[model samples]
Target: MPCCRLLWRPQRPNEDFRMNKQDLSEDTEVVLLLCGRFGGEKQEPHQPLSPREYSELAKWLNACNLRPSDLMTDAGRDALSSLQVARLESKRVEFLLGRGTAMALALERWARGGLWVISRGDMDYPKRLKRQLKHAAPPLLYGAGDKTLLEKGGLAIIGSRDASESALSYTRSIAARCAHEGLAVVSGGARGVDAAAMQGATEAGGYCIGVLANDLLKTSVNRQNRIGLQEGCLVLVSPFFPEAGFSAGNAMGRNRYIYTLADQALVIDSALRSGGTWEGAVENLKNGWVPLYVRTPGEGPGNVALVADGGLPFTLTADSTDSLVDLFASRPVDDVQSGSDIVETQQLLLVPEAMVTAEAVTAEIPSEPVQEKSQPLVSPEALASSPAPQPATATEVLAPSEAHASGDAVGTVEEPAMAEQPAQLLSCLSLDMYADFSAKLASLLGGGALSEEDIATQLCIEKSQAKAWLKRASEAGLVDKLKKPVRYALGRQGSLC
Candidate 1:
């Protein structure tokens, strides 16, 4: 209702006022001014505007053609009289004037600390949060360091602040592996697992996105973190004020930001009953925002329950860097098994013709009516001679075999020809005719770089469809063709868009 209260600290008499009003956008300056005015004071209750309140305010501003600064003007007062939220009369005007008067000093303080802010309307706000949280996303983000890192999705490593040394070590190793794979490491910027993961990623010359709940101004310039920040490998951001102290509610709420910003999440250790780590993991699983992984044989009961309740188990080895990359980069499967659990060696079996009895063949047939052998789907010679079929129409939806059958006629052929001779025919098939495969193709391309083969394997689409999607993506400037063999990476414009 009051848009939250501000607690102003007295500036030293000799403190330099280096920041000017021009340093920030008119909108941002006004928001900060409002925050400075109404935000919590020392020993006073600190009640920041709730997401719903922010949404309401945004709607009012839009409807009334009022910028935040307009609220302090004569016209603003007239407009405020018409808005329900600002109808409190004298008190509202008084508060607005108070904050407006302090705007200069507030800007100076923020500038002195090298602090910056992005409102929800800003283009630089993390797209992931905008997509995942939508209306509930933070209205403002105060941050420091490389803002571009926010655009790079990565693995989120989260756990208790007092995690076991082994758990922390596991997190660091996984983070390092993620770095080796060219992924950023996302964390809550807390102690133990979060800190270990961030440190590991930066130490490996990889990027890290730290979503801090409080004390962002203090933490961003920490001696240990300064190098990474300066190197553009670390970005620390928070939804709270730069000087806001730790609040349990803020910490728990910030977990969603960490999870939503990441491509996937790993839980090292969580208490079974409660705690920020446990609650966050549970909320993430419930929302299905990302694929949640819990360390197997984890240090706490929470791990066992999480796995039982659909959390995937992440088991890593010293040499599993490639496997780890694939795990996070690939889309999640219904089953919770990791790639490392899959055996790669192929097994060959020798089945004698005699082993396939007539009864066995008959049993394999579906109970549904089958086309008679007399009317073969496609005689071998006919398939070879016929031109490739045109894309199917909606009413003519047919399986590959059926489509082939309807196209041409020829004499029946031997079984071996039927099994091995149609490679050329299948290659000519147009996968665009299938809508489901087309959608999957688009999804895979947006996720990351993929060779045609990778798309086929990952999306379970046909090779031809994968190739077609890659070509389409290239044409649309959504992907770039790379090197020999033609792998595709998301195009610069594509990532920015």
Candidate 2:
């Protein structure tokens, strides 16, 4: 069953991540030069800057109202010469930017091989990356096939590369069920559980997303995947290069992408205290990327421990699970499960990099596993690509002080007088963020309705907050409130204008 491959550098693909210019937008080209490895040189003199380094540079750019693309221009070059950014030398920036030849060669090769790349700043970039992971989002992503499949959120089925046969069967069944329900089944595209899951879904003629840790070039052209790729039913993406090899660090880093990309994550199996599965699940819990579910009858110690750590325990039997949509049905955020309850939820919003504080990039994350991370959570403007439109009349927001009474709808609690509320609780939200947030939220619902749980999960906000946002969106006529299951769908567009 061709399980997930282990850490081994392939001798071929001949040349990997040799980037290029021309086809790429200036922004992406600049990003690649600054952060990408141009696939040559045993010991290159000017190593690319890291994400944290790029972030620090971004802050300076935003401060000066300059973009990365601007750096290539004479005016931007003058600003670089005249301005002093801490810890960054003008020469260092120049050296990185000088790799135009390497960039062009790499891109040309990658493109010829049917690979494409997108920068975080691109509107086509997955909104989930911007909203869920925020600045932790990768600067560049390389992939093969349709990029739109990346946004069609579905369950992220993750497990050990060495999962047992029974667990593999379960993963396959679940993936197939998701396919039958018209939901995309996302996985690491590794061997073992990952392989089984994708196989099941694609075999069932269902769409799937393969978020690979490495080996995209090989995977894209692999005989087993060629049919799916050709059918436009599969998308394989990587934060690393298309021709990059497997590294344990890359494996670990890739897990966050899987979790963030999905509506929810389900662990079919996991190793205890180690492996990419364990580390990724631990990180997801700390970050609350989404409500995770561990297989109920799994043998692995990691599965047990994860449930104890607050993962929802779920059981999916193939025949009984015809529809995956029910799995994401609405649930209250505050009325969370007591022990092991199933939850059906997912959603996310985009944040512009300029709003993130410079210090956040400098803060070190803990080395060991921790239940909760200290990083500030991305506020739940869920799904805004740009600022939401301000209506002629003022619309209310779900402030911290406003609490839900009960159920999914905004509970009938009387609003507290503005005078009585704590100053901090009523603090103003960035109007641009809110506007962008609403427009994005509208876009998300434009397809189908979503529950409070779905909104909360995607936006990375509390469920109560999702309920509040829905109520406000409903009032503004941006979204229509549906009863019975209590979901919100796109409202009249003309009404907003």
Candidate 3:
């Protein structure tokens, strides 16, 4: 079933629900206890755990074979008092978890305002954030509107809040083009370029996902957003308090969400050296989260330098807006950044306690053109990219000592291997180098059949990468491709039952 079900839809006033602790999932409630500030316009009574601190706590809990929900139980509470975890102070941990009253009151208010909260442990939490950001994924998310829209990948259009008229016009046109192509527009929902892009898409009857830094409660009831919410074309989410005011730190921190949530991002405008737009674009380029595209011809002061820093340049105008889809078609894999989840644990669960340490990884597959391969499973060739180059004439070399033992002539030789091979081939790296990367993948599948998204989240790789590897493995008879729901498992295991 789709995770975002309509629990309620009032014909008038639009008050959605009343989610008390009993109605909340155990993981969700625990996450709220650890990270939520839960109140409108009230001073924070206690410090919440930051991402790093939460990660440490998670690891410690995992080591103890305890889930976060376990901490809420009487026996689990008793165990916590007897246990000693250096990363988590007993008093602080207890204090945070004791905020059930505050959490309950806050949840009641949020639910009444047509708002909903999801924890990282919730199956509905945005997979892009967890897959791309890994442990840095926020522990909790507060949202309004159709949460389903969060997973619909689209073009993220970003720029300065005070962008020029030409830039704003182009941003709107490009966003409208995206809508025409049935794409969602992702943005920070701030004024200027963010607002302009969302406006263009909405006006064109397109979907959008907004990652707000603050004021989620107010936005939930904004008349302009009502139609979009009713039609399930928009979802506004925040990592901060719903009624919280905006701050510079919050704005900058939320920039990563805008980039990771999209398949591609366009820098409509940005100044050189500083500003949230510039920093976010620069960080995204360095992190390789997605292909960062900057506006050309109408390049901002920092646009040229952004391109120099690995941002792709594309020209988008009223005349060229139709090329939006073509622009997103190319996502080159460049550098591997840590936050990009180049390697990590099996992230099948949003509950940090359920996460396991990833097996050490030595493989780094480059995203390159594939040549014709012999195996034909899904199609005519293994990778099915480019035509392979002509192989050079074979050369002869002396046989190994094992051949001598087999009564072969001492000077007997064998032919050399093919001279030309596709860069995408693991053999190009070394014979059986696929083992380097395939171990974790095969291990994950060893349990049972799983879909592409599951495998990607488990192996902490991009969904595209997971799909490519699964296809190759299936062709090689290393994995069994199953029908019905579309899943995979190690074929060598002979299709479990």
* Every candidate's lDDT: 0.57, 0.61, 0.62
Could you say which candidate leads in TM-score? 2
TM-score per candidate, chains pooled: 0.60, 0.63, 0.62
For candidate 2, the C-alpha RMSD (Å) to the true structure equals 21.0
Report the lDDT tens digits of candidate 2 across residue range 389-434.
Answer: 1111000000111111324345432222222211111111134445
In model 3, what lDDT does residue 14 have? 35
52-142 per-residue lDDT for model 1 (tens digits): 6666776788888887756656777677667677423434434544554345555455656556677776777789998999878887788
Best by lDDT: 3
Alpha-carbon RMSD, each predicted model: 23.6, 21.0, 23.3
* Candidate 1 vs candidate 3, lDDT winner: 3
Error of 2 at 177 (Å): 0.4
On TM-score, the stronger of 2 and 3 is 2
Q: What TM-score does model 3 achieve against the real structure?
A: 0.62
Assess the local accuracy of residue 108 in candidate 2 as a C-alpha lDDT between 0 and 100. 62
lDDT of 3 by residue, 77-105 (tens): 77777656555677777777776666666
Candidate 3 deviant stretches above 4 angstroms: 1-17, 20-22, 40-45, 82-87, 335-497
